[model samples]
Target: MGIRVAVAGASGYAGGELLRLIAGHPEFDLVAATAHRQAGAPVSAVHPHLAGLDLVLTATDPAGLADADLVFLALPHGESGAVAAMLPTGVKLVDIGADHRLRDAAAWRRYYGSEHAGTWTYGLPELPGQRALIAAAGRVAATGCYAVATILALAPLIAAGVVSAEDVVVVAASGTSGAGRAAKTHLLASEVMGSLAPYKVGAHQHVPEIKQATGAASLSFTPVLAPMPRGILATVTARPTSDADPADAARTALTTAYADEPFVRVLPRGSWPATAATLGSNACHLQVTADVDSGRVIVSSAVDNLGKGAAGQAVQCANLMLGLPETTGLTAFGTAP
Candidate 1:
C-alpha cells in the first residue's frame, strides 16, 4: 500500500545504495529493480551486502518500470535521457545522472560529447528555493557527487556576498566508488590502494552544473581518486569580496544557511569535517576557516558520495514529490566504528 518505486540501474554502487535505503524506507515499496548486464540475476549476486533483498534484477526497460509511481534513473551519464523519455509521463522521476543537470546545451555537448537531453529541476534542497522546486517538479536531476559537496560548501558564502564569485577553487578527494562499478585497469585494487591520484584535472563534467547552481563566474576543480570505498572530502576555497574577517563571515553564512536543514551541518568552530564522519548517511558535514596566508575563505566539506550525492538525494526528492515529509525515511547522522 506504499508508494511504488523502481530503480533503473540497480546493480552499481549508487543503485545498490538506493536499494538498501529503499528497503529501509517505510513508505517506499521497491516494486522493481532493473539493470543492464545484471538482468535476471538475484540482487545478492551483484550486491553481496543486499543479500536479504529478494528481488531479481530485470533488464532496463521502461515498460518494466511503468507500474511504479516513481522511478530513479541511476543510469550512466547520457543514458537516462532516452529511458526517461519513454516512461509514462505520469511516473515521477529522479535522475542521478549528468543527463539532465545542465542548462546549457553547448556545455553539455562539449563535456559529454552527446546531444543535450534537456534540463530538469535541480535536486539539491539546501539551495535557496530549491526544496519547493523539487517538491513541485515531475522530474528532477540529482547533483553530481563532487558538485554536491563543493556547492554545499561554496554557495552560502556567495549568496551572503561574503566571497568573490569571480574565482573559486576546489580540490577534492573522492573514494573510488565515485568512478562507478565498471571494470577498468586503473581501478584495480593493487592500482588503487595507497594511491591518491588526480584525474580530469582541468575539465570535469560537473563544472557547468556547479557554475549554474552557485553562480560562480569561474571555478578551477581538481578531483583526486582516493583509495577508500565510499566518501568525498572536498576543500573549496574562494577569495573574499571584503577584507574583513572572511573566516567569521564565512562561518556565520554557512551556519545560518543550513541551520534548519535536516542533513547539512556546519560544524562548530575549531571542528573539521572528515569523510569518515559522514559515511553511510545522507548527512554532509562542513567547516569554515580563513587560509592563513591568502585570507581566502576555506570550507571543508564531507559526505558519502553514494548517499547524499546520489540515492539518498534521489529519495529525498521523491518524498517531496509524493507529499511526504522530507526526512520521513532519511537519516541525518552517519555511523562510526
Candidate 2:
C-alpha cells in the first residue's frame, strides 16, 4: 500500500511542486492539501498545473493533516512550528520551511526573531553525516534554497579542513520564485528583467543558517536576485587553509561526500554547473575549480530552487522516513528548450 501524504500550504510554489512529484510517485498518495488563504477554492485555481487533481484547498486544520501517515509543511518560516506541534507523534512531518533547520535555539532567535521550533532531522541527505541522520529521524527540515546551494558548494571543503570557514565568501544568484509565490514589487518582471541587484547583502537571513550548517562562525554571504524564472547558480569562493591545492582538495572532498548520493552529482574537472543546466530538475549539479595564484577555490553549484532546494528535498526526506527507494518520484532530467 502507498503511504498516504498530506501537504499543508498547498496553494504555494513548494506545495505545488510537491504535488507535481507526488502525482507520479508509486508509493505515495496525495491524501489532503491545505492552504489558509486559498481554503475553499479549487487547488487548480491557484496552481494551474495541478488542474487534474480533484482535490480542493482546505483550511490549515490539524484534523486534516492528522489523517495522513505523513505530512509536508510548506508554510512560511515562523509558521510551521505551531502546526508541527499539533500533528500526532505517529505522523511523520517534513518541513520545507526554515523553521526547524537550525540546531541552536539561540541561533534561531537571532536570525528568525521567534521562539525556536526545536530542530528536526536535516533533509539534505547529501551533506556529510546526513544520510544516517535522515534515516533515523521522524521530523525533517528541508534546507533553504540559497542555503542548499551555498552549503553544497562549500561544506566539502570546510569539512575536509581544506578551507578556513572564517575567510569564506559566497555570492549566489537566484530566480524570483525563491522569494515565494507572493506578489512583490521587486519580483515584478519589468523590474527584475535586465537587472541584477542584491538584497540582504551582508544580513541575509540565510547567513546564520549557512554558518550553522558548515560550522563556520564568520561567513560573508551575498544573495542576489537574478532576472530569471527558476534555478540558482551559487558561486562560492574561499581561501584554502594552507598550501593544499584548492581545486584538487575541493574535488576530492566533494566527490567523496556525494559519490553515492542519488541526486547530487560532482561534475568532471574543468566543467562547471549552470542554472540552465538544471532547470526543472531534482538534481543538484556541482563543479569545483581553483585559482592557485589567487589562492581561492571556486565552487559552483546549480539547482532548481524549487526542486532540490525545496519540494523535491522534502519528498526525498519523506522517502527516507518511509524506508522507500530514495529517488522514488524525483526527476533527474533538466528541461531543454
Best candidate, TM-score-wise? 1
lDDT of 2 by residue, 1-337 (tens): 6789999998888898988888889989898999987899887888898788888899999998998999999999999999988889999999999999888888788888889988888888887678778977889999999999998888888989988888788889999888898888988899999999999878888887888788876888888899998899998988888785778888898998888878788988778888887887888999988875797988999999999989988888888888987888887778887
Clashes of each: 0, 0
**Per-residue accuracy of model 1 over 1-337 as CA lDDT, tens digit each:** 9999999999999999999999999999999999999899999999999988999999998999999999999999999999999998999999999899999999999999999999999999999999999999999999999999999999989999999998899999999999999999999999999889999999998899899999999999999999999999999999999988899999899989998999999888789999998888999999999989989989999999999989999999899999999997889888897
Clashing residue pairs in candidate 1 are: none
Q: What TM-score would candidate 1 get against the native?
A: 0.99
Q: Ten consecutive residues with minimal summed lDDT in candidate 2?
A: 238-247
Instruction: For model 1, give the 10-residue run with minimal summed lDDT.
Output: 328-337
Candidate 1: regions farther than 4 A off = none
- What C-alpha RMSD separates each model from the true structure? 0.7, 1.3
Which candidate wins on lDDT?
A: 1
Q: Report residue 201 deviation for candidate 2 (angstroms).
A: 1.2
